[model samples]
Target: MKRIGKWKDRLAAYVDGTSGEKLDQGVICRDDQCTLGKWIYGEGLAQTGNLPTFHQVKAKHAEFHVNAGQVVEAVQSGHQDNAHKMLHEGSFAKSSRDV
Candidate 1:
């Protein structure tokens, strides 16, 4: 227990990196596919998988959209968004006060 806690504290970045699968390209929602609003309002979910997906799947989909979108945007613009959505309930979204 102590060792696990220590690992969590000492290697936050490294630990998070290994938790998700990498992809060559990210899925972007278009037209009927985008659902950031539904996710934020808790009306739906957003999850990702190894295979290609068009819309939100589970609660994690929103996070995947954010993460994948950031990756795509960064690769193209050389910058990443402040929020990184890797998995479901991975990290709380930054509050307005935090910004």
Candidate 2:
């Protein structure tokens, strides 16, 4: 969650033209690479795999990564306006909320 907030900060800054943080889409695209993601696919999966909601959470998390990566691409491609929309009201925002 905190990591997501950090991403929000970076993207927000980029949209505002106040920062130039280089986000790695390669890293962002991997759902199992981040801390929360690692847990969700590792110990969390081991313990909660039997629960009906567990898979839902995992799927949402993966979707979040995909959407996040797209936002990163938009930012890196000089499409700040589109990136802002993706970050605020599109699939990226929806996936973040779902996760």
Candidate 3:
């Protein structure tokens, strides 16, 4: 969760013009690439797939990535304000909590 929070912070920095790290929408769109995602798809699924909440976690995790990618798309399109807003209180923020 801390790593995931840092990922969002990196995007926020990019959108704020404070960091030079290049944002990649394509990469952010792949939820399964993150550590949490890896566990969800691998050990987590194997260990807890039968749990009722497992499916919800999986779905929310996927949505979080989609929301994150949308924020990156806004940034890449020259919409820093929109991206920042998203990082704070829009789809991105919602997913951050949901996930």
Candidate 4:
């Protein structure tokens, strides 16, 4: 995955529940399909297989100001090891206030 800079804003809108029509814009992928949308809507993975792991996903959520419910959803849907890593070593672990 590219640096988190690209899809940051779109993911923020998604977690904020204020995406509105921007929800149609999707994540920034080579095929223009929305990776986050697939996860949020349970739409299954895109053909490209460029899925972000739980740590990366949650880190971006924190970095972009995502909400608590979205964070919980990420943990529920994420890989166990990735979620563990985020809980133990990533931003999610550091920001007790956010949790």
Candidate 5:
């Protein structure tokens, strides 16, 4: 399996230079699990707030970091087109009921 560290690296690059910033991928906190796809934080998830979908982890170049609020705003912005694409292409929104 791929390590979270590697994933974080990719996420950092994706977020650093892509439209993912306008897509509400959220942040990748120190929690064990992820907030947008799966909450492995041991405690649970970081409540998705008023947003309609989970958070996303992205990267652009160096290393992946967290972009919490921005992602949520993307979901709230009513861009279901991009949201659907991201969700479909990611493990974050695999289930129809997830997002």
Candidate 6:
């Protein structure tokens, strides 16, 4: 089993709406949990203040990260097409260098 770390735990909490802490009205603090929380919430400008609901965050996190993991695995296993398809479906814009 994968050993979940503190960041992952916090991310799980945020994603599940179980964090019990109100969303910070300002930028997420630079603490460890906040740093990871921001990532799991998806990167953005701090001033935008347009945050998604817990359910949306959780679903997108799972979709992107899980598909990204599959893409990495496929590339490592010599399945370039599979990786490309995953990236395309995930709406990740591939630069010329990435091709």
Highest-lDDT candidate: 3
> Scored by CA lDDT, what does every candidate get?
0.35, 0.85, 0.90, 0.40, 0.35, 0.41
Each model's Cα RMSD = 12.2, 1.6, 1.1, 12.3, 14.3, 15.0
Rank list by lDDT: 3, 2, 6, 4, 5, 1
Which has the greatest TM-score? Answer: 3
Q: Between candidates 4 and 5, which one is better according to TM-score?
A: 4
Summarize candidate 5's per-residue lDDT along 16-52 as a digit string, tens digits.
Answer: 4444533334434223334423342322234543333
Better of 4 and 6 by lDDT: 6
Q: Clashes in each model (backbone N, CA, C under 3 Å)?
A: 5, 0, 0, 0, 22, 0
Question: Could you tell me which residue pairs clash in candidate 6?
Answer: none
- Pick the winner on lDDT between candidates 2 and 4: 2
**By TM-score, how accurate is candidate 5?**
0.24
Better of 3 and 6 by lDDT: 3
Candidate 6 C-alpha lDDT tens digits along 1-99: 122244334433443446674434122222223343465445533533364664454454444444434544554566666656645543322211121
By TM-score, rank the candidates, best first. Answer: 3, 2, 6, 1, 4, 5
Model 4: weakest 10-residue lDDT segment is 24-33
Q: Assess every candidate by TM-score.
A: 0.26, 0.86, 0.92, 0.26, 0.24, 0.39
Query: Which regions in candidate 3 have their CA more than 4 angstroms from the true location?
Result: none
Task: Give the Å shift of residue 97 in candidate 2.
Answer: 1.2
TM-score of 2: 0.86
For model 2 the local lDDT of residue 21 reads 70
Error of 5 at 30 (Å): 7.4
Pairs that clash in candidate 1: 46-58, 46-60, 46-61, 46-62, 47-61
Mark the regions of model 5 whose C-alpha exceeds 4 Å error after superposition. Answer: 1-71, 90-99
